[model samples]
Target: MSSSSQGEVVYTPQREARSAFPMAAILLVLGVGVLLPMALARGLTTNSELKVVALELCLLGTLAVLLQPFWGLVLVVGLLYVRPEESIAALAGMRFTLLVSLVALASVLAHLFLSREKLVRTPFNVMLLGFAATAILSTVPNWNMAEAVLEISKLVILVLLVLNLVRTPQRYRAFVTTLLVFTAYLALYSIYLYFTGGAMQQGELARSQATGIFSDPNDLAATVAAGLALALVRARNARGLMRLVYLLLAGSQVWAVVLTYSRSGLLSLLLVICGFLICSMRRKAISTVLAVGLGILLFVVAPSRMTDFDRSEASANQRFWLWSDGLQQLYGRPLTGIGYGQFPEINGGWTAHNSFVLCFTELGLPGYFFWMGCLYYCFKRRVPKATPEEESEEEKRDLVGARLALSGFLFSGFWLSRTYVPVLYLLMCLPVAAQIAARGRPGPQQVKGAEWLRDCGRIGLISLGSILLIQLMTDFLK
Candidate 1:
């Protein structure tokens, strides 16, 4: 293969194969799979018995720390979907997510230490570091220092792992594929829940809500919307059966989002559809027509009970109240604001329910700025200048999908406080990886704008626009 070929693109590999790591991980998984059921069958009822099993499991997981950081990424994604404690009452106090996260973290750390490689730097690294620093500083005023620290630490670790591991385009593609598959599984499972009467019921109306990682209907909807955006991109690029497969995935995800009956999710889905149309349709007329058609389809299919634009609904009013209180806090402490995770503590047990508001109120002005800055970079960063012949079909799809994914997240985030989720950080990594990969392609020239002021201006305009939209919504509700 030529050096310029897509197959030849260089990606950093894990440092060493201790040969024992995968064996250890396999043995640990198999041991737990085999022994846990046996223990349960034996009616192990004593606390000591449970403790012994738990200790053995933890020790095995620790021993499974492997040289392959990619495996850690895979493990973390799988772990995100399952909450053992929630699904099993006996393990209610196990803190399974923490345990899985630790194991994944250890694997990545082991790989990095063996490789002696520096962390991959991107344009937003400094911005992210600033945000993390501010968040830590704000923790001093947090309602619960331990909880805040724990939450922030998890976010930091996840962000670092993504930044360091997903360096090349191939890795980014694999990461997104895994994300799409997991999201699809969640969508299918949620539909099953709805059919089985596991969904929320208000009289005869049923609205599907997932469990474990996406327990909240809105969260489930958000993930589905994002995944649908990716599937749309893939469908546009695919041919034959693969195209049909992607379309099926997209359809299923759309169905799951509608089943959630979350207005924000619906709005986000519409925006994502618009993005998809824009990317897939070259002619403006075709794009506009398809978007309108999609809107009509949604109007006809969505359940009126949830889709009836009722501004006076209790949930709608509650969000407004939360925003009002969040704004008040933001104004009162405009510089430093309340500490991390303190909004619910102070606002009568109400969360901000708005990502922008949550950011400003939690980490104050600097946090808000850095957060906006990060988004600006993600959406607006420059890619290597590729000629028509140089840009591959897959590259074009990746670029479009990442942008649409960002759009979906932001649209949904307007009504949900998910600023710190691992998925969000992983999405942010996409464009960075794309840019790096583009630069590595043969015969590519780097175009330089290097205008920080212009970028800052754009970020400011976007932030203001978001605030104006929120204000308009508030006034309309009034």
Candidate 2:
């Protein structure tokens, strides 16, 4: 058969073999886990409170991770080991999107249902539930369903994709490489928008604003900032051809970031760069001077369009209206707030833009605070594990570089909730999980029942969250 006729992409014999097992496992798991909850809960009347039930399900699903870190690790590592996406696109075929989405869904479902695998707990699922909880009890129609499906689809894909692709440091590097390539596209796209999209506005507070595909300069900048963190980590540790490639790509991504007139993104990027420089443990004095110099340069060279962002007039004004209206609704029913995903119903789907505020509008104070607490738990709780051969020169360089990369991500996440970005999700989770796996366990060990109780607690929270979604799904007005 002609090579072209056979299709340009073909996998090696081994790749074809490994892909089948995980794909099937994912399907079987989701069928039993998520859909079953919907079926059993079908009789519940959809109402503002139903959204809360859905939120409970998300929480339960997420907490289910605590019961099975090893399983979570398996899904994550398995994803890396096989990397079906790059090997043979045909394996996923046209259903690739659904395929990955289902993997994400299934992983969570598996975590929740696999009572035997208490070690399957994962922070990713915890966050997924908490994020979903924000939309519980919303008056908005189908808000619970959309957010639930989207949350499951994304988190599932994230867990499956990263874990499958990141089996080793080398595999982790490949993931970063793919990410850098994507960043390059973002850079080029930003260039396209800078020159053509919006007429360059003058004397605006957001003067240097650079909007690309996102239609918002800030969002575009934020995305690139994230890519830069990964690129920097890879560039620092790479060698030979790969090293040179990573450096060039990282540099390109940084340059692209400068073009986006996002003050906040630049601020976040600056913090990441400086954080890495400090974490690198280079001579403190020199690092200080260098960081200062770089900061000055950034300030001087910030985009001509950034003037618009300075005032925050557009952003602040919109935020005020949303907040005031949201407060009025939330205060009336302070405990439940508006239903999960109900923020749109409040003001026609205009986001609070800021994620923290977004939670408030959708979930009110109770749900918002609970969600934040979970996020805090995930982000703050991390300890890098020991690697073998740290005594060697190359290994030391690697150790330092990996930490720097982690620093970049940690610093950047301060500016945006990266819990969802597929690349960012893996970049952060892979290393953190590797650290835990290397330790031979995740966190301090406790008795089996204690762990079960912990998961049970999460299940209770999520089960209540499920009811929240159900309420939203059933809200009589809608």
Candidate 3:
């Protein structure tokens, strides 16, 4: 084929015939080589034989990891959703964690020595390293040092991988696209569960809680809420059929979140919807009407078991007690509290059920500062503000969506203990990555030390304020 016009391809008869010949040869080879083997060689059919085949496939995957380390990062992303340990507990069990660890090791090593380019030491990079240090040091006083170190280390590795590897807008977009596609599967599955009433029952509600990485309906809802945020932003930027597809995806995710029966999930979705109304769509009248209708419908349709605020329900009483225990722990040990992941042991075998409470009680003051500082940096740092004409719409939408998603997460944290969740950290890293990519090269714009310190101070005040607010709520409940 040749170009008849500057940007157009002209297919000639000779070129078409040549392509047909290659296609014919490929089909002939596939028919003879593939079908002949299947017809003559009867493939292994027993359980033992399948195990052997799985082992061989794993070996081939190992070879692929060795050949292309970046692909290892992509695999890790997929595994985060598939969560083989939970999704295929009967077969893979915790072996998936081992696989991810190996892949992480390879990817980091390859990035360090094999790749010519090095990760830029931006402010975000420093903040992440500081957060990692804080997590490690907090473990020094941990109730279970080994467990804290292992879990926190895994989280840190995932965060660092995103911060270091995703260095361009294209790479950032690719990750978002991959994430959205994976979450689309979750959205569809949740919708299916809603229709089929396949969700697990908890208390008086039939909740669409997921197993594996997300343990409860609230966590599942948070995941969907985050995806909904991203979809809203992308749909705003998309055109024609693509826009319609994203809008549909967003709608499905909203329905899934609603099916979870999690107040936190519903709140997260509301935050994103409000964000859409205010930031981009500006459908104020529609938003107002929808908000009012949703409020009435929730009260009318939701179970009295959940809606009762008189502390008559089991979950309400449980959360109140958990929050009380966690707050008491924070007050008792303000500097270094009960230690990371120790709330369950101290709080009647239940999580703090509040992210800020979990941080304050578990990590104590230092860890709280570090953790909140990371979030504050993301929230406070201005997206590299060039003129609207200068900024790419993709970058603009990404930053907006990330902030909205973070808002949803923080809002959900009032009821969900997701302090160490990888999804939250991943969302935090996105704006940092997008800003760096938009700048196109290393520059002074990448550095912001003083602002980080300010965020730490602000977060400290916020932590104290949160404690007082909880105290007032506790007193009121009493």
Runs with alpha carbons beyond 4 Å of true place in candidate 2: 1-96, 103-120, 133-147, 160-167, 192-215, 307-309, 320-334, 381-431, 434-478
Error of 1 at 398 (Å): 1.4
lDDT to native, each model: 0.72, 0.48, 0.68
lDDT of 2 by residue, 32-73 (tens): 587556644652554435343533443343333333333333
TM-score of 1: 0.83
Q: Write the per-residue lDDT of candidate 3 for residues 1-478, one digit (tens) a residue.
A: 1111111111111112233344435554665566545533443443455444544444445445555454556767777776755755334543654575576556455545543444455555555666666666666754467776777777777766776666667777887887798788787886777678778777566777555756477888888898888898889889999999999999888878877777777778777887766677457787777766766676676555435556646677778777887778877888876777678876567888888788888877777777766776676644223353445766777888878888887788888888888778878877666655554443233323675465556778976776789877766663
Pairs with backbone N, CA or C atoms under 3 Å apart (clashes), candidate 3? none
lDDT of 1 by residue, 426-473 (tens): 677666566555434323222225455666667678876766676677
**Count of backbone clashes for each model?**
0, 93, 0
Scored by lDDT, the top model is 1
Least accurate 10 contiguous residues by lDDT in model 2: 4-13
lDDT accuracy of residue 135 in candidate 3:
62
Sort by lDDT, best first: what order?
A: 1, 3, 2
